[model samples]
Target: MRMRITRRGGLVGLAAVAALLVGASPASAAPGDASAYAAKIQVTLLGQPAVTAGPFAEAKADGPTANSLATVHLPGILDTGVLNASASRDDQTGAVQSKASTADVRLTVLGALGAEGAGTRQGVGNNTVGAQLIEAECHATQQGVAGSTKLVGVDLGSLGSVDATPAANTTIQVSALGVDVARIVFNEQIHNADGSLTVNAVHVTLLGGVLGSIGSGDVILSSATCGPAGLPIPMASGAGLWLGLGLLGIAAAPAAVVINRRRRPASALAAEAD
Candidate 1:
């Protein structure tokens, strides 16, 4: 028996991912001296189950540690399903201290896919899917003593979906710097998959202030939470259906196997070396 499969949404998905990554602010050190503060990030998906293939396969991610800056990288393949991310920060200084955090991440769902078939495809043909979850956020804050007001700033960028369903959200943090600054912190969480959730945070504080400048120290904390095993939710199709339809044309090729298999192939295909 012979079946044919063709990847349809490659160009479109690549374009979206590229635009998402390139169209962003260039990274630079905070204006004036960097603030000394701390941050904590946490994220969770309400209705997602565990999966062996989707993003969030590894047990726990390499998280940030005390007094260290943290960075988390998502594997393209394992990144999928519903997503929720948030960040919070608290900072302290000799004259000022305050705290700030982004509580809710509205929406960021992208590139999900669904598949239909009895089992793995044969030698000449294979089943494939393209999935990814991505985001970039930055935050800062400064606070003075009690009775003194608190100033916090935050920026959040996340894009995700089940397939090519395309759910996106972007938020920018804006707060003025300079003052008898006290505290600072930042937190963020990205929904990975059913069982896997990636969370990260960065916290810091100032050793002291200079005559004309400020000095700061910070700690980084990151974590990945994997829930107990359970049923896998049906992944989204995104633009995978387009590809599946194209492949269906071949899978349902004229009178090859009497009738084409009813089962469907993954909506998207990510090129992977066998």
Candidate 2:
């Protein structure tokens, strides 16, 4: 005799298939064990030079600033994770000089799973990392305009390599009569299941000079990454279901904006100097 499958049975089978396709297995699909697992986090920064100064000289600058904090509670791999990355530049012109600074902070629970029990393990900590670039220019109508650019960035994963040549391109310009300035800063932190946390911070700066007009100077770049090692933990199936749903909410969140303001006029600079 032939057997018939019910609609409910078919729906259950289809759900199982969909979960497997996304790397979720019966063990992994269920909540994870936080006590025995650890996570890997990375961050990067990049900057570009494209500023000009003269009869209508102009300067532009931009850079990345990212911060994240998370609590883990399961035994699973959180590898190949990049928490934050950004790049920006500032462009201006005339006899005017300008300075501005802004900061952003975001707190998120990447994922959490596992049940409460005598065998459950718990911990708390933080990790931080960063990168930066600075460039400036000077000009002199008498002596032809001249300029120089430099890049100094730190890697969160390896503090020893902080002073090395940055993986990104950096440029600076200067004139005999003019002056330019630039600065970059980055910071980060992470918490793992082993009850431990690590923090990393990096800052970069650039300076140059020449004839003086400082006709115009442009460009800056930087990047960084960090990772920590620790044990794994257990997670309950119910927890896994909710964590998965939470990820969907994060994916649908709105994106942040990057501002690029117009250069100030020479008259504005003179008034500020006064």
Candidate topping TM-score: 2
Q: Per-residue error at 2 for model 1, in Å?
A: 21
Q: 1-274 in candidate 2: lDDT tens per residue?
A: 0012233334444554444334333331211111101122221112322222111111121212222223222122111122222212111111111111111211111111111111111121122122232222222121222222232332232112323322222221211122332222322223445322222222222232232111112211111221111112232346555555454443233111111112556687588779
lDDT of 1 at 75: 28
* lDDT score, candidate 1, position 219: 22
Q: How does candidate 2 fare on TM-score?
A: 0.18
lDDT of 2 at 183: 24
| Residue 37, model 1, lDDT | 19
Candidate 1 lDDT over 11-113, as tens digits, reads 4345444443433322321121111112222222123332122121111112211122222233211222333232222212112111222221111111111
Q: Return the TM-score for each candidate structure.
A: 0.17, 0.18
RMSD of each: 28.6, 34.1
Task: State each model's CA lDDT, in order.
Answer: 0.25, 0.23
> Candidate 2: RMSD over Cα atoms?
34.1
The residue-level lDDT of candidate 2 at 14 comes to 52
